[model samples]
Target: MKEKSNRLLSLSAIGLVILFLIAARFLTTAESVRQSFWALVPPIVAITLALITKEVYSSLFLGIVTGGLLYSGYSFEGTLNHVFVDGVISVLSDRWNVGILCFLVTLGAMVQLMNRAGGSAAFGKWAGKHIRTRAGAQIATILLGCLIFIDDYFNCLTVGSVMRSVTDQHRISRAKLAYLIDATAAPVCIIAPISSWAAAVSGFVEGENGMSLFLQTIPFNFYAVFTIAMMLFLVAFRLDYGPMALHERNAVEKEDLFTTEERAGDESLERPLRQKPGEVIDMLVPILSLVLCCVVGMIYTGDFFSGESFIDAFAASNASTGLVLGSFVSLVITLAFYMLRNVLSFNQCMDCLPEGFRQMVPAILILTFAWSLKAMTDSLGAKEYVAAAVKSSATGVLSLLPFLIFLIAVGLAFATGTSWGTFGILIPIVVAVFQGTNHVMLIMSMSACMAGAVCGDHCSPISDTTIMSSAGAECVHLNHVYTQLPYVLTAAAVSALAYLLSGVLAVSGITDNPFVSLFGGLAVLGLVLLGIRGGAGTKAE
Candidate 1:
């Protein structure tokens, strides 16, 4: 009955989208709409349909169509060509995307190899004794996620691979696990000075020490800090609300790691039951090797072997090529280790290859649609629209500038599915707006922008980090998005309020003490959660 209701609701949402498009066709000037609010319709439609319908593929496709129509003046042939030829095919044809897909498949294969060799199971057993409680398991996951701050992609998959078995053993839902992985990924990186995110952010600023500036803004990054705090609070207090609470309840009561059947019976596609005897060392060694090789590969791509500095190499490295190289090497090493240890035969190892590819098929499919939707949104000029909007709106709201920039950044990043792009477009404008004076305002605004970008990325479905987080936890993509949305919104709301306070304080010369605003945001978040839980308790009674 519930499934049927969901299907009907999804259909109704689709119907409404079609009506909206039809109405928009006759009502608006489509071709001349670039850099307008119309440019954001695609991702907005996609995100809304995804939430309402609890599906991703159709929502993204419809969004692509909507974007194509909006970009091409509602011509059917134009939309057909743009949506398919200029959008999906183009993205698929891009070398970077292909490399990322290949990397994902290769990592999938490695995960399968580990499962076939009993490495994952062995680690689970080893971890089970020490990680006896759900809170501890979640804390360990958060720690792993924070530790892998080199890249968000690496953090999501690596943390997921290592912690999946442990979380499953403790009856933690995949949705919750994905939330933890996601909450820790970009949020942690924005503050980690050595991370890819830090480098990406630093590259966006002009005429200043970007790294130094980024560090200065860290104390004011209320969203990222509050997100981490919220995770710890939710886990420690068992204060999950919304869909996540139901998921947690189901997992605790039923030992069901997945609340939905979007995946196979087990969260993993690999057959652990037919595995060979292996110790935790088998798992730890290959994973550690993968991590080391990936770091080396990243620096190698940046010419670290040529005597270049580590930080510069990391800043210059191509994540796709590095990940692919590292994962491929790790896969080869794992297979060879299994053979030498006689834990799995050559045939057995070879057999797991296709199985691993099969396991990651769901993620690949979602990523393809997501990439396509982003392409459509890009083609519709969402970035230009957002940049112009922010620039235009910055004229008179000096006191509210940080809050306004943060909100603009959130909408832009959420629409375009790129935090780097969001900050890149806005940070310069921020610099220009506060040049030669207002140093405190500039730093606070930059932090607000950074926090907003991360928050939006956290909420965006087409975001690579969000997709990878789902893959890491082996959660249904939409389920992860749904369960985590309330948490992201909570953090974002508090952060927005904090930014508002900071923006006002900057104008009043009280911006130096950002901790005051941050603590206030955290307190607000706690109070909000308590109020929500109290309401829920009343309803339960």
Candidate 2:
């Protein structure tokens, strides 16, 4: 009955969308509703339907079609061309997208190789002794994610691969694991001064030293800081709510690793090739090499060997290209290492290439649809509409400007699935908004933009970081998205309130200390956790 009800709801929602598209023709004769509020409707539709139906691919495709209809002014031929040709084909055809896809495929193959060779199994045994509890596993994953703050792309995949075994051994749901992976990726990167995200944000500023400004803004980055805090609180206290709590219960009580059919990978995460130590090197060596090579590849692309400084090279590096080169090299090195170890026969290793690719197919398809949806959203001028709206609001409210900017930034980033783009578009306008009138407010608003962008990116299902995290944890993509949303929203609310207080404080000339809002946000987050988690021990306890 519930399943039937959900289907009915989804169909009704689709019906509404169809009605809207039909009505749009009479409302506008233009080919597209570019640079308008309607520009955001498609992604909103996509996100809503996905959440409602627990279906990702169809939700995204329908979103693409909605954008097509909006952009082509409800013309059938134009909608088809717009969605297929200009949307999906364009995104897949891009070289950067291709590079990332290849990296995912190659990395997937490497993971398969390690599994078949008993390397992963061996590592699980090694970790089993040290990581004795679910909290330890979660915290360890969080620490690894923070440690790899160099790039979100690198952080998500590396943490997922390294930590999966430990997490599964504790019967932690992949949904929860994915939430941890995602919660750390962009949020950690956005605040890390040495990270690729910092580099990207710095380039957007015109007159000021971008890195310096980013550093200054870090204290005011409430969403990022509070997100980290929330994760620790959740794991340390064995607390979860909503879908995640259900997943956790299912994992621990039922021994059901995945509660959904979307699980393409196996409990290979929990199974070991051996209970001994020899095969341990199989997992560690390649992971280490992959990390080493990826960093080297990133710097190489930035022209580090050509005499550029470490930071400068990283700033200039093309992450997509760097990761592809790094993963390809790592795969070759792992294959050779496996052969020499005789853990798997050469032919068996060869077989893993296809198996790995097959395992990654689900991720690839989802990513493609996601990318296509983003393309449609972009073509509709979503970014421009957001920028214009934010600019119009910036000058209207003095005490509320920072909070309003944060909300706008979040909305834009969530809809478009790109935090970098959201901040890139907003940061300049923010700088211009308060250039000389109030220096403190300027900093606060800029920080809000950064914080909100990461927050929105965290919640977005189509976000690259989100997708990568799901792939890394081998979780069903939509399952990860839905489970993670409540956690993200909890932090976002606290951050939003903190920013609002900062704005009010600034109006009272109490803006000198960043710690005011920072500490206050932390307190609120803790209290919320305390209330939600109770005087917590693990669920079993």
Candidate 3:
């Protein structure tokens, strides 16, 4: 009965959307629709459908079709060509996209190898002895995520791989684990000086010392800092609310990490093999090697060996290519190490190759669909429409620009599901808006852009980082999305308020200290959490 109801709802929503699109086609010219508010309709439709139906693949594909139709003026042949040849094929063939796929496959294989070697089981035993509580397990995951601040993709997979055993031992919900992995991924990378996110942000600011500007904006990064603080607070106080609270309760009380019937991955992959138990060093060595090699690979791409400094090379490096090279080397190293330990024969290791690829298939499929959706948005000039909107509204709201920019950024990033693209679009506009006028306001606005972009990426279901987090934790994709959305929105609300306060202060010329707003935001977040905790307690009683 419930399934039938859901199906009917989904169909009704689709019917309404189709009717609206038909009316829109007759109402506006294709070129005008492509360049206006209609450009955002497809993603909004996709997001709404995903949330309502709890299905990602069909939702994304429908969005692609919507985009194709809009871009090609509702011609059936044009829509087919645009969505397939121009959208999916175009993104799949991109060099960087291929590199990311290689990296995912390699990382998946590496994870399978570690599991088969009994390294993961040993680590679980080791952690159970030392970190006995659920809070401890959660905190450890956060700290590990913080340490791998090089790339969001690397952070998601690596942290998830290493910590899943410990988290499972404590009955931590995979949704919770995924949230921790994601919160630490892009947020940590954006704030870190030597990360791929910083490099992307720096590349956007053409005239300024982008690195210096990024560092200066760190204190004003309310979302990232507050998110870290919120995670710790929630853990320390044993607080959980919204869908996450339900997931956690099921996990703690019933030992059901996933309340839903869907198993996102093959549970057998995470199970200990029938071989003798391996040492913890078996897992540690390969992960550490991957990290070191990946860092080197990034720098090498940046011409570090050719005499460029470490930081400079990192800033110029191609993260996708570098990750592929690094993970591939780390795979070879893991294979040799496993052989040396006599954990498995060559045939077993070879068997894991296909097994690992199969494990990553879900993530790969979601990513490809996501990339194609973004392609459709791009073809319709979503960025241009957003940029034009921001520019047109810039004149009278000087004091409120930071807040406005933050809101705009969040909406854009959420719709498009790419923080880097959000930064690319908004950072340049912010720079142009306040390049010579107000340096203080410029810094605040830029910081808001980063914060908003991260916040949106943190929440969006179609986001690659978000998808990777689910893959890493082996959680159902919708479970991760639903569980994390409330937490993300809470943090974003506080960050938005902070941006408003900061913008007002800067415009008033009373104070330009970034910490004024930073500390203020943290205080507000603490109070909000306390209130939530109190409310939850009262309801329980």
lDDT of 2 by residue, 340-452 (tens): 87776788788888877887787788788878888887888877887898878766588898899899889888887889888888999988877777888888999999999
Error of 2 at 228 (Å): 0.8
Error of 1 at 5 (Å): 3.2
How does candidate 2 fare on TM-score?
Answer: 0.94
Clashing pairs in 1: none
Q: Candidate 1, TM-score vs. the true structure?
A: 0.94
Q: Taking the tens digit of each residue's C-alpha lDDT, what string does model 1 give over 24-72? A: 9888876667777888888899889988987787887788888999988
Shift in Å, residue 57, candidate 1: 0.6
lDDT of 3 by residue, 1-541 (tens): 9889989998988888789878878887668876688888888888988998899999999999989999888898999999999999999999999999999999999999999988888888898899988889998999999999999999999999999989988988999999999999998998999998888899999899998899999998989999999999888778989988888888888999999989888978776564567789988998999999999988888899999999888888899999999899999999999898788789989988999999999999999999999999888989899999989988989879889999999998999999999998899999999898888888899999999999998999999999999999999999999999989999999999998898888888888898898899999999998899988621110
TM-score list, all predictions:
0.94, 0.94, 0.98
lDDT of 1 at 193: 81
What global local distance difference test value does model 1 have? 0.84
Clashes in each model (backbone N, CA, C under 3 Å)? Answer: 0, 0, 0
